[model samples]
Target chain A: MTTPLVSIDNLTVAFPIGRKLFGPPPMVKAVKNVSLSIPKGSFVGLVGESGSGKTTLGRAILQAAPITDGKITYDDGERRYDIASLSKDKLRDFRSQAQLIFQDPYAALSPRMTVRDIIAEPLEVMGLTKTREETDARVREIAAKCRINLEHLRRYPHAFSGGQRQRISIARTLAAGPKFVVADECVAALDVSIQADILNLLKQLQRDLDLTYLFISHDLSVVAHVCDYVAVMYLGEIVEEGPTREIFANPQHDYTKALLAAIPSLDPDQRSRVVSFERGTVTVDG
Target chain B: MSLLSVENLSIRFKTDEGLITTVENVSFDIQEGEVLGLVGESGSGKSVTAKAIMQLNGRNTVYDPASKITLHGGPDIDILSLKRERDMLPIRGGQISMIFQEPMASFAPAITVGKQMVEQLQIHTTMSKAQAKELSIEMLDRVGITEPARRFDQYVFEFSGGMRQRAMIAMALTTKPRLLIADEPTTALDVTIQRQVIDLMKELIGDFGMSILFITHDLGVIAQTADRVAVMYLGRIMEQGAVRDVLRTPAHAYTRGLLNALPNLDNLDAPLTPIPGDIPSPLERPSGCVFHTRNPELAPGSRYETEIPPMSEIRPGHFAALFPEDVQ
Candidate 1:
């Protein structure tokens, strides 16, 4: 088998609580010892409820969050770099190979920037393109792949709808030509009808570009449909990890079962059978 | 008897663009101890209709004078006719209680959760501070809050998101209002918490004997909780019927599109067929069916472009707005 693109070994992220004015301050363990691996050209889903630290895990992989312990190494079938201890030059190079698609399209994209500039900003900031023409060409190219209308690129973000804004956000993220993409709740804010469109677009892009995706969302139905492999998170730990179908059909963990049972099935004659599960609140580091 | 009845209710907001219609000729009834699910997309006017019943619209809102929004309490007393705050006061928090989408913002930061509940009970009823506090703690525990007394003294930020939502529900139920308007109460919560909250609401409905107008964008939630479901589109009721019938055999094109778009866990590879076009701005609603602009099955005719379509009964108690040729 080919080598894994990314491997995280016993990772932990802790945040200091209150202030260090008095004695040694306590720390909130946002994410505990967790180990996971992402294969090349695979769609992996990380799901959990609030305080699950799924978002923190995603950010840590992208080097956006503080990695308190353990090692995170990324390899693209070439040179490997320690994400936690990246040099300035290595970090700069890592930018072109890894990208993030933010959850809230409304807040993610700059309101003042036009759609063209928003998509082109990453290229210009990274100095990936030589001239304005090159940046414009690259923006148009990715926008087309994302199925965005070229005419709308001239308009500001305010002029577009939620779905359109998300497409614009996707296009901007992909403009960096990253091998791995972390889409954090990318379709959560969109309407159901529009969510399907975005989901399809993401899959098509993944297939066409040979890109790996870390799709993080709270919605299980969406995850079941799109993800190849699934990892269920609870209180910042992976409670279950398996094939999406296997996990959905028979969830092992109580938290995973509760999440599945909570989803109102679309079928009509289906009586919602409330699965008997403990609703015990897990207060970590309290 | 039905607790509330809305007949030919139309609402328009005076926007900078024009008189943007939000609700058009929408009508529904909520019987006592019944849960009605109002399911629709972003522009579906479900929230507007709920707000209209509570007289929560702003100064820019224009409700048709001929419209009938009757809030039936026992038998008589039309809530719409009561203009004075003194008269409407008894109905606002006394008869109808509302819970919003965001619980964090709805609560005050500085005040303790217990203090807020006590203040609401005092204003609406003749309960003393001591009596109110006791009942409030009971309400919190009933909603599955652990250490209710300790939680009562904590600020809103001190409670987790799920706990805060439970507190909101507990506060809403303190008055034991006859009608509960839960507008996307669980939409912001995680799936696990959402299930707990949905179950709690259903259980509360049984004991409280209160009518609920549950508004949400997810049709799946409607199928599970609501006895009946109404599918709204661009501020109009495209389809209204039993949850099973509506989900099994959706009459309107918009309803069909919505069902097709939802990601089905059972069928992993099914392509989500999104509705063709954007939801037309309320200011420029289509001449006939409001959904006709985005509908793929728009019959080729000048009539559809000019004349308005009337809602026709497709099944027993099921009404859908569609042209004859488009009916499946």
Candidate 2:
């Protein structure tokens, strides 16, 4: 088998819950023993509810979260690094190859920065380009790839709509030319109509750039459309991982089944007929 | 007779940029025991339409002079005509109640859940303080809150997100209002909590025979709970019909775009066909059909750009603004 672009082995992220003064501080165990892999150029989706640790798992893979145990390796076909055990130099190199697209576009971008500045910051911070002309060329090229209007790049983020801001967010992420990207609920905040436009753009860019995506979202409907392979996370563990069609057609886990059954559809009268598993129920299968 | 009738209603916001027209000549009805789902994307004016009925918009909101909002079997008061706060009170909570997207904003943090309920009930009804307290507790139990009396004394913060929504619903339903305007009430909730809330609302609707003007951007939620679905865009009704008809056989291009954009559980790998171009700013309202700019079927320099498409009945009880292609 080809070496996967990203690999994980028994990754766990634990956050101290109580204050230091409290007796025997307990860990929240946000992510517990999650293991997964993403092949090169595959659009992979990580889906779960609010406390399911899907977001934490994504951050852990990026080494943004404190990995309490286990190993995550990133190989971009050029250089390899143990994400959790990287030196400062290796970390700086890794930054050029791995990037994250935030869920809330409003809070992610600096309001004070112009769209050009926002997109150029990553390239400037990484020192990928030395001259002003080089930086402008890269920013405009990536901005066009993300389908942003070139004229709008001079305006502040507040001037653009949600969809436009998202394009800027995508441009910034892609400006780094990362081999692997984690787009965390990137379209959840946009309108349904606008959401489709963004999703389609992301798909087109993925093909053009041969980029591997780790799309994190609570919306099953979105994941169903964008992802080829999906991993259903629950309480910090992946309960089911399979091809998107197989999982959606015949979801093995009860939680996955419920999540599928819960999407409010265009058909106003289509209610959930399946029995939902209540909290504290013991699972018969993984 | 319908429980509520909204006719020729239009709303515009007085932004610094100018009067940005949001919702245009929109009209619909809510039956005594029916759920009317207003489905649209951001700037579709679904929320604005619902809010117009409640007169909930700020001072800068301009309701068109020709707007007529009548409540049947209500207090015989014209909702739009009621100018004074005292005049709007009986209609606001007594006959009609509203639930919001965020429950926390509507709920008070300093007061106990029961105290707020009792106070709301006292102000609406002629019940004594003790009587209101007892009734409010029973209402909480009715909404399936475990240990109603014990939970009543807890502050809004004590309740979880789901529990807080349930409490909000309990408070809204206490007055036994005839109409309920739920504006994306489950948008912020998890799938599981959203399911629970939908189930609870269905039960309440059946029991009380109350009409619900359900507003949400999620087509799936509207499909599950609403009897009739109205698709709105740029402050106008794009289409309206039975949920089954509108969703399964959407006639309007905007409605089709919304359904197509929705990720289907059946086809996980199919790329979402999002409508191209962002929703036009309210300030630059379209000249003809509001959706023409984004409609794929639109021909350049077509009549749609020059002439407004009037809403025409396409089938029995199904209405949509027809394009040139739709006529023949």
Candidate 3:
């Protein structure tokens, strides 16, 4: 079998809660012992409800989260990186290959920065280009690739609409020449019509740039729409993982079935609400 | 007779830029014990129309003289004619209660949930403090909140997202109002939690015999919950009909565009077709059909560009912004 572009092994992310004076503190295990893999250039989706650690796992792959245990390996057919164990110099090298697209576009970009400056900042921070002309050329190229209006590059982010701002966000992410992108609920904040535009843009960029995506979202229908493979998380564990079609067609886990049954169908006669949510009797949130 | 009737409703807000009309000549009726969904994208003025029923808009809001909103419940009350906030008291909580997209926005973080619920009951109902507290606890339990009595003493920040929403629902329904204006009540919730809330609302509607003016950008939610539907674009109602008619066979171009934009679960292979062009800014209002700019079937600079079509009957109970001959 071909080596996957990114692979994980027994990843566990825990945050210590109550502190102890003499002993260890109690912990909340956000991501339990789990493993996932992304094939090269595949749009892999990570879907789960809030507090399910889907976001934490996405951050862990980029070494943005504190890893209590396990390993994450990133290999792009050129250089290999054991993300959690990389040295400072090696981590700086790996940073250029991995980037995160935030969930809220409104909060992601700096309000005062011009569109050109925002996109160019990443390329400059990574020192990808030496000269001013080279950086300007790269920014314009990415703006066109992301379908942003090249003429409006001098305006601030406040001047653009939500869809236009998202295009700017995409341009900034890809400017650093990343091999893998973690799109964390990138379209959740936009309207459905605008959401389709962004999703289509992401699909096109993936094909054109040869990029692998870890699309993290709570919306499953969207996952089934764009993802090649999907892994469903519940309470810090992977309950199901397979091809998008197979998982949607025959969801084995009760939790996965419950989730799929919850999406309201567009057809009036086919509201098959087969699964019902019963609040956790064991829940102890005081 | 319908429980509430909104006719020729138009609303404008006084802004620094100038007077801008957000809702234009929209009309609909909410029958007793039925859900009427106002479906649209952002800036569609669905929420503004609902707010106008309770006279909840800010002081800068200007309601057109031609606009009329009437409540047909015991003595017919002209909603638009009420001049004072105190006069709106009976209609605000006693006749109509509203829930919003974010429960946090509606809830007071400083107060206990139970205290707020009891206060609402005190203002709206004749029940004493002891009676109100008991009833509030009962409502919390009814909405499926566990340990309702204990949770009632907790502040809004203590409860989880789903629980907070349920708490808000309990507070809204505590008055036993005739109408519930749910403005994207479940949009912030997860799918499973959203399903629970929708089910709860359906169950409550059955138990209380209430009418709902449900506003949302989601067609799927409307398909599941609404008995009747009105499709809004820009500031106008492009189409209105029975839920089955509108969803199965939409007559308007904007309605078709919205349905096409959603990712269909059955056919995963078909590419998503977003409505072309951005939604026009409120400052640059289109002259005729507001949706004509993004409309795919019709051509720009045509007669329809300047001629605003009326909502003519397409079928027995279906109406669209096109004449009978225009229906394809």
User: Best by TM-score, which number?
Assistant: 3
The candidate with the higher TM-score, 1 or 3, is: 3
* Separate DockQ for every predicted complex: 0.71, 0.69, 0.79
**Residue-level lDDT tens digits of model 3 in B1-328:** 5999999999999999999989999999999999999999889999899899988889999999999999997899999999988899988978999999999888998999999999999999899999999999999999999999999899999998889999998999999999999999999999998888888898998998999999999999999899999999878999999999999899998888888888999999989988888788899999888888888888657666887889989888899998557976
Docking tier of model 3: it is: medium
lDDT of each: 0.87, 0.87, 0.91
Worst-scoring 10-residue span by lDDT in model 2 chain B = B262-271
DockQ score, prediction 3: 0.79
When summed lDDT is taken over every stretch of 10 residues in candidate 1 chain B, the lowest stretch is B297-306
lDDT of 2 by residue, B1-328 (tens): 7888889898889989989888888988888899999988788888878877788888999989998899987355678988988988988988899999998888888989999999999899999999998988898899899999999999988887888899999999999999999999999999878988998999998898898999998888888898898998888899999989888888898888888887776655566788888877777788988888988988799887878787888778889988546843
The i-RMS of candidate 1 is 1.3
Residue-level lDDT tens digits of model 1 in A179-270? 99999999998988889889989999998888999999998899998999999988878989999989988889887887888788777567
Q: Write the per-residue lDDT of candidate 3 for residues A1-286, one digit (tens) a residue.
A: 2579999999999888778797777778888888999999899999989888899999999999999899899998789999889999898888899999998889999998999999999989888999999999999999999999999899999887788899999999999989899999999988888898999999999999999999999999899999999999988889899999999999998889999999999888887666754533212121
Question: For model 2, how does the per-residue alpha-carbon lDDT over A74-118 read when each residue is reduced to its tens digit?
Answer: 987779999999999889889888899988889999999999999
TM-score of chain A, every prediction, order shown: 0.95, 0.95, 0.96
Docking level for model 2: medium
| Best prediction by DockQ | 3
Q: List per-model TM-scores for chain B.
A: 0.96, 0.97, 0.98
By lDDT: ranked, best first? 3, 1, 2
